[model samples]
Target: MTITIQQQFSINLNALLDEAGVPASGFGRSKHVATSMDVGVATAGKWLSGKQIPEYDRLERMKEWLGCSFDDLLGRTEARGGRIPARAENVLLNMVGTRSATRISICPDEPASIRSDGVYALPIEGDVMSPYVVDGDMVCFMPAMSAHTDGVYVIHVAERYIVRRVNLTTRGTVKLIAENARYEAEEVDLAEEVKRRNGVRIVGVVCARILVNR
Candidate 1:
């Protein structure tokens, strides 16, 4: 028999709750989910009963709290031979323009250690990084306030977010290198930028890239 998405979600949620040691049926199950997701008990009950599915943000939160992927939560993917799917929260490049978060199932081959809660997925918007990380690719990163290593990172500066390979040079400056030769590398003084309130913030370090099929 074919199962609807709502039914699948209910089944998956119950299984996840059971795996987490919540009782199969009772106020405890709904209350636990409601508390964890910060929703009303009636809403949680609807989810538990297959009467409704959560919106995007709530679904993302549910997956994160349950330590599972979107596929796992929605019954899109199943474990085989003891291997679980990897997952990450999907965030947009322009945070100010859009404040939304969803979930994406990472490639199953991804290391199990990468399934941590700190991981996030950001879709590439332009060809600035090109050849290496082109437009349409989704890059996964770990949130970081400062650059501890010279590598590819997502940074917010001059009122925009950009992806670049950062190199900390002498004289309190950092060089932003674009993989594409068509673009020129730019160097900015970290202290001067901060003093000017340009807000040079290192958002995160890029750890994995999901390439788009040509």
Candidate 2:
């Protein structure tokens, strides 16, 4: 049987949260999620029940907590000009007129800096890194650099780029952590030389994220 959007969302939401191991009774789930963004369990319960939709900001936080793609959480939506919609072009242009150049870079000027270099753009596809990085925000990447300074990065694994923080362990294992407390970090066995060989492949260091209040 075909599933309606609400049904699909409800199923996916519950499953994702469960997979993250934040069952309703545990304060760990609620505490971790609340650390990055302000949200309550009652509000989360309402969302999971499909009784209400979270505001854009909260939705972004939940996405990060679930550690999945935006499409994975929100269901698939049509792509906008090859990148998710961060802001209307008109609005960005107007903001650029007033803001400091160092603070924000207009989209039109993006290509000039990104096209030729190993750098590229990866729009954040989900909420796993919300508040700091949200769905639809553009994340810059540099494919040539494999080394990360123990922080968040855009990585291409299995042909898809995912954003997560990098943690180097004393045992020489690498852990990919989500910004949200709800999601557990994933560890991979890789030597420093192998990592430098571009086997895992670092897409780029995330400089900053651009989020619109929508």
- What residue runs in model 1 are displaced by over 4 Å at the alpha carbon? 1-117
What does each candidate score in C-alpha RMSD? 17.7, 12.0
Write candidate 1's Cα lDDT for 1-214 as tens digits.
3456876677567656644545323225677788889999889988876678999999999888989888777754344232322222212321211223355433232222334345566778877765445576666666566665566787777766678878888666788888655689988876666666556766766654544421
Q: For each predicted model, how many residue pairs clash, with residues at least 3 apart or on different chains? A: 0, 7
> Which has the greatest lDDT?
1
Which stretches of model 2 miss by more than 4 angstroms? 1-118, 191-199
Predicted structure with the largest TM-score when compared to the true one: 1
User: Would you give me the overall lDDT of model 1?
Assistant: 0.62
Per-residue error at 198 for model 1, in Å?
3.7
